[model samples]
Target: MSAPWLADAVVLAHLAFILFVMFGGLLVLRWPRLAWLHLPAAAWGVAVEWTGWICPLTPLENALRERAGQQAYGGDFVQHYIMPLIYPDGLTRHTQLVLGALVLLLNVTVYAALWRRRGGRRG
Candidate 1:
């Protein structure tokens, strides 16, 4: 209801979505049948970072915060909250790219392992 509370809610939701996008592949690895859901989400996450497109949720959350009279944060929510805990100074573009690459690499590795296990079962 209040500005700060609304902003906090937005920040929390944004963080949850980021976590889901980053780790959802692990879930898919456990249940390979969910590739249909996880693959698209993973692709979208990668595409958003590669293209420098602001996630729709970011803008919507900011708008809501602004309407609530809270100061809207500029960068991605990860940069605002998560990065500070790990990196003292701040997040740079290079760091963001590295993080994105790590997510992509992790998902790729999981998918490959799953494929091998499935193939072995068939063999």
Candidate 2:
């Protein structure tokens, strides 16, 4: 595959992963086994945001862009792409912390509901 195509694929995959990390815990409600996959993913997502670490995908995408004869962009994937669409003001450390907290809050709420529905038992 060409570098441009590969870069686009990476961007799409990154978006999907973000969505999954943000909401995949809800899937555990229907498939208990999913918790094994989603719990760790959610934690990793939270950790990445809280620690202000750029995801590995960002560099891969940037490299792909360069290989495609395109200019490499600065900042993480969000700043280069998602931020332009949703957060015109740009991303900041505070925003990253908020994103981390949001991830934690949403997952906790979903897991709490799951726990309550499961008779307060650990699943």
Candidate 3:
């Protein structure tokens, strides 16, 4: 695929992953085994936000954009794309930490409920 095409694909894939990281808990409600996948993804998402660490995909996407003669965004995926829509003011370190905490809290709440539903048995 052309660099531009591939870059666009990366953006879409990155967005999908972000959505999954944020809301994958609902999936776990249906298939408890999904926790194995959702938990780690949630962790990574939180880590990225709290640490302000650039996910590997960021560089790959940036490189593709550069090759395609597009400007590369500086922040992580959510800050660059999704933040503008949800947090028009933009993402800050404080906001990032909150994002991380939300990920943990949300997942914990969801898992706790799931556990209760399953009678504390691993599914």
Candidate 4:
């Protein structure tokens, strides 16, 4: 495939991953086995936001864009793509922290519901 195509694919994959990280707990509610995969992804997502670490995918996407003779962007994927839609002012450190907390809160709430559904028993 062409470099531009590859770059587009990476962007789509990154977006899908972000969605999964944000809401994968709901999937886990249906398929408990998926938690094994999702828990780590969710943690990594939270870590990326909290620690201000750029996800590896960001650099990969940038490299692909560069290879495609396109202008590569600065900052993480969320800053480059998502923040513009949600926060026109742009993404700040405080906003990242709040996003991390929100993700954690949403996941915890989902898992808590799952636990209650399972009778509060541990496996």
Ten residues in a row with the worst lDDT in model 2? 77-86
Task: Output the worst ten-in-a-row residue range by lDDT, candidate 4.
Answer: 114-123
Q: What overall lDDT goes with each candidate model?
A: 0.78, 0.91, 0.91, 0.95
List where candidate 4 sits over 4 angstroms from the true fold. Answer: none
Quick one: best lDDT, which candidate?
Answer: 4
> Is 2 or 3 the stronger prediction by TM-score?
2
lDDT (10s digit) by residue, model 2, range 1-123: 999999999999999999999989888889878999999999989999889888999999999999999988888877778778878999989988998999999999999998889899556
Model 2: residues >4 Å from true position, as ranges?
none
User: Candidate 1: where is the Cα deviation over 4 Å?
Assistant: 1-9, 120-123
Model 3: residue 52 alpha-carbon error in angstroms: 0.9
Ranking of all predicted structures according to lDDT, beginning with the best and ending with the worst? 4, 3, 2, 1
Mind giving the per-residue lDDT tens digits that candidate 1 earns over 1-123?
A: 876576678778877767767887788778878888888877877777766667777777788878877778887766767889999788887777777788799889888888887785563
C-alpha RMSD by candidate, in order: 2.5, 1.5, 1.8, 1.0
- Comparing 3 with 4 on TM-score, the higher-scoring candidate is 4
**Tens-digit lDDT string for candidate 3 (1-123):** 899999999989998888889899989999999999999999999999999998899899999999999999898888889789989999999999999999889888999999899889766
